[model samples]
Target: MDWQEISGNWVLIPPRPSAIVHFLGGAFVATAPQLTYRWLLEELAGQGYAVVATPFVNTLDHVAIARDVLNKFENALDRLYATKTLRKAYFPIYGIGHSMGCKLHLLIGSLFDVERAGNILISFNNYAARDAIPIVEQISPVFNVEFTPSPQETNRLVQEHYQIRRNLLVKFADDNIDQSILLAKLLQPRFPGMVAIQTMAGNHQTPLGQDVSWPVGQVFTPLDAIGQWVKQQVYRELNQLKREILRWLNPLS
Candidate 1:
């Protein structure tokens, strides 16, 4: 697999024992100019946490592109794990994704179901809402609401799609408020303490864009204010995780 270094400043935060932190990029974008998390990485390394960022090309077409990028990331993780880097026995791995990257994270996280595989999604939205237009068009011709598929059959099909939508929303909330709520619900069942969602006030692209001021200082524009908020949140979460790891390793005080 061809791997590309996401152009931008990247810093590695060393973790005690040895843990891996994976940073996933957004859709149609390679890396953010601000290089969000540089400060966090330094802080984490100081506290004994190893951090790494894998830059992948963001091509928004088929799922193969995302899968390929994620595969490359997984390979990097394998290398790190083989090197005997972190403190945790199972290699505590956390994933941070923005926008479409968040969707990719869910797909990968769900597929792997690793022991310590935790995830943080920023600016996550209901996948259905984001792709509603296309989904509707695709299924519209299959089932005619006016005639074919009978009432029972129509109900089943509609219910199936509805469930899919529900799952998407539950996995990724459209805005910060609802997004946090959705994340809480989803994690409570499978990973009560492992999942976290911090909804910063911004649209989808905020986490990737560094600057918050643009398009007349409005939240909607080329980028959103949430971009800064997401970066700050990532740093905070990484540092917090590092502290917890330190505390775990050295409990007596």
Candidate 2:
């Protein structure tokens, strides 16, 4: 669990990893990826995957974001190879994204010649900036930022060009913001039986992180037991989600 800077990007690498994982978090989350996706990345690290969590303030121009994603991932690999940090510079690279991150991966797949094994799209949402970002609808008239791919354009692009062969779309049962079903519909025409859609009992933020501490000020409350039960359910769902993700990514295994 060490952090290093590569080509001006902060990355966390685990010791002696077998493969690589490129992670992208949801929209407007500019916090360090290492912190925002701490639980997911740490678990992946423990599973022997070198995870490179790229931090970026998600903007309207998703195509631009996708380009930057490629740059960071390629640059990281190049640096590792140049320094002889890993025996092999390139390994099976998997794309892992939550929410808006899924759109970027889909864009990457549409573009030709990216070395990606597969992708896991969790709680996918491709809402317009005005809709996705609260109060942006009110403020956009004053300061407009016409985000590229505009949700409609994202579909147009995917319909015109999508080269991904394997995809795993996971949607949580309680996630009302999820568009995984819609995404699966779009990808099914292109990838056919290649897309695997899995439904689990959790919400959009289930895999991100958890707070397990019980409320200490109160001796006990009726909701306290319910809260504990819900927390346990979250942990269980997350573990199952991880297992399904790994299973889909590692087909031969």
Candidate 3:
């Protein structure tokens, strides 16, 4: 299905969607999530989900970014309901985020009054400006630039204010910058048994499925066989990721 823009967010809704997923991508690629996360979001839409991927420019004020995206997502939902694109019947909403996006979702859940069935936080990263951005690192000492909430302040807020109970913290095996473990530690205490963590095999960029399709010829050559094998391996990890997400999203199923 083709993606449609609703209230400044990229949306893909199938007929009679079972759930709504509010998605946020990583720091840089968030500006074009429709292109960057096309494969994963389209897969979710195919699985009977109304995917609303909100694109935001990375800023130091994560709190403000969270509020802005939340507002846009709500507006898009309202339009979908009003236009009869989605049924009037209740559909559970879930927040899914990657890298820096995870921190924004956490802030929204902590500071706003939004309801979510649960949140699937993948590769949650809350790093200081110096560490996260190289240019910022070079100029920070001279210009004094830093995130508004700061990494420490963000943690404090999550520890003291985050309200959502059910959470699935996904950590990647080879992601050096991932901080899902720390997030899980903070959230587990607040909600106890409600917080669960899953470690996957791929790295941080696993969600960004670069699905390159190569055509096969009638006279299959060695290069064709190698290309096909590579394509299968690339999609295998993505398919596994999708299955795990679906399992967590619908545990009873």
Summarize candidate 1's per-residue lDDT along 129-232 as a digit string, tens digits.
22423545566567522222222332333233221111212122234423435444554455334443443334444343332232335446545556656656
**Clash totals in order:** 14, 0, 0
RMSD over all Cα atoms, model 2 = 4.0
What TM-score does model 2 achieve against the real structure?
0.86
Cα misplacement distance, residue 171 of candidate 3 (Å): 1.0
User: How big is the positional error of residue 42 in model 3, measured in Å on the Cα after superposition?
Assistant: 0.5
Local lDDT at 197 for model 1: 41
Q: Who wins the lDDT comparison? A: 3
lDDT of 1: 0.44
Better of 1 and 3 by TM-score: 3
lDDT of each model, Cα atoms only? Answer: 0.44, 0.80, 0.92
- Candidate order (lDDT): 3, 2, 1
Which regions of candidate 2 are displaced past 4 Å?
Answer: 141-145, 211-231
Best by TM-score: 3
- Using lDDT as the yardstick, the better of models 1 and 2 is 2
